[model samples]
Target: MINLGEKKLILASQSPRRKELLKGLGFDFEVRSKDTSEDFPINLDPSEVAGFLSAKKAAAFAHEIVPNEIVLTSDTVVILEGKILGKPANEEEAFEMLFALSGKTHLVTTGITFLTLEKELTLSDTAKVFFKELSGQEIEYYISNFKPFDKAGGYGIQEWIGFVGVEKIEGSYFTVMGLPIHLVYDVLKNL
Candidate 1:
C-alpha cells in the first residue's frame, strides 16, 4: 500500500486500456481527456517523441491544475526500422504495420507524465516484443476482428493476436499494453 499526500489523482487520457491498467494498481483517480495535437518534429527519436507528446499533454493542463490535484498523461508508440509507427489511419495501414512487424522484433515505448501544482515528472518505458512470422491471412483476420485503430503497432498484447503471434517480450508487458503500472506505482509512491 502507498499513501499520496492529499493529492487528488487525475488521469488525462481517454484510452480504456490505460485506465484499466491504472485501476489495477488500486489507485483512485479521475479521468479527464484533453484535446492536444500529437505532432512532433520528424527528427526526434521514437522514445523522445513519446516523452515529448506525453509532456505536451500534461502541459496542456498546466493552468488547470488545482492545488491538491495531480494530473497524469501518457503516450505510447511503436518503433520499427528506426521509424515511428503511430496509430494506423485505416485498416490498410494497420495491415501494413502488422505485416512489417511479422517475424521481427520491435520496440514499444510508453511515456508517462505526472504533473502537479508544484512539480512535474516525465518518464518512459520501452519493451522489446518479438513476433512469430504471421501469414497474410492471419494479419487480415486479426485486423478485421480486432480493429486496432487506437492501438499503437496495430495489435494488443492482451488480445487474441498476442496469444497467437507474440513469441517473446523483454520488458514490462503493461508498457506494451499502454501504461507501465509498476513505474507508475513507484513514481506515485514517491510523489
Candidate 2:
C-alpha cells in the first residue's frame, strides 16, 4: 500500500467510473470538480486530446493547490479510424456511434494529470479494444437499457454491453472503463 505521508489526495472529476476506480485503491480522497470545457482544437490528433483535456481540467485548480495537496484529474477519449468519438447528445446519436464501433477495434486513451504546488506530471494510457459484431437488436437493447449518452464512445466497458460485445482488449481494461487504476496506483506509489 502506498502512503500519502500527510499529503491529501483530490480527484477533480465527477465520472462515476473514475470515482469507483480511485476508491478501489483504498485511499481516502476527496472528489471535487470544476465545470471545465472539454473543447479541444480541431487540428489536434485524436491521440493527444485526452492528455490535453486532462491537463486542462487540472489547470482549474492551479491557483488553489496547497503544498500538502496532490490534485489528480483525468479524461478519457475513444478513437475510431483516427477520429474521436465523443459522448452522444441523444439516443439516436448514441446508437449511431455504437453502430459505427460494431465489429471493429478502437482505441481508448485515458490521460491522467497529477499536480502539486511544485510540479505537474501528465501521462496517458491507451488500450485497444476489439468488439464482436453487434446486431441491431443488441445495440438497441444496450442503448435503451444503458442510456449511454453521457459515456464516451456511447458505451462503458464495464457495463453489460462490454460483457456481451468486447471480444478482447490489448491494454488495461480499466482504461476502457475510463480510469487506468493500475497506472494510477503505480504513480501514486511514487508521489
Top candidate when judged by lDDT against the true structure: 2
Off by over 4 Å in 2: none
Residue pairs with colliding backbones in model 1 are none
Tens-digit per-residue lDDT, 66-142, candidate 1: 89898999999999988998889999999999999999999999999999989999999999999999999999999
Pairing residues by index, what is the TM-score of model 1?
A: 0.98
What is the Cα-based TM-score of model 2? 0.98
In model 1, what is the error at residue 25, expressed in angstroms?
Answer: 0.9
Q: Against the true structure, what is each candidate's TM-score?
A: 0.98, 0.98
Writing each residue's lDDT as its tens digit, candidate 2 over 1-191 gives 78899999999988988998899899999999999999999999999999999999999999999889999999999999999999999989998999999999999999999999989998999999999999989999999998998889999998999999999999999988888898889888987
Show model 1 residue runs off by greater than 4 Å.
none
The C-alpha local distance difference test score for the whole of candidate 1 amounts to 0.92
- Candidate 2, which ten residues in sequence have the lowest lDDT sum? 175-184
What do the candidate models score in CA lDDT, each in turn?
A: 0.92, 0.93
Relative to the unseen true structure, what is the Cα RMSD of model 1? Answer: 0.8
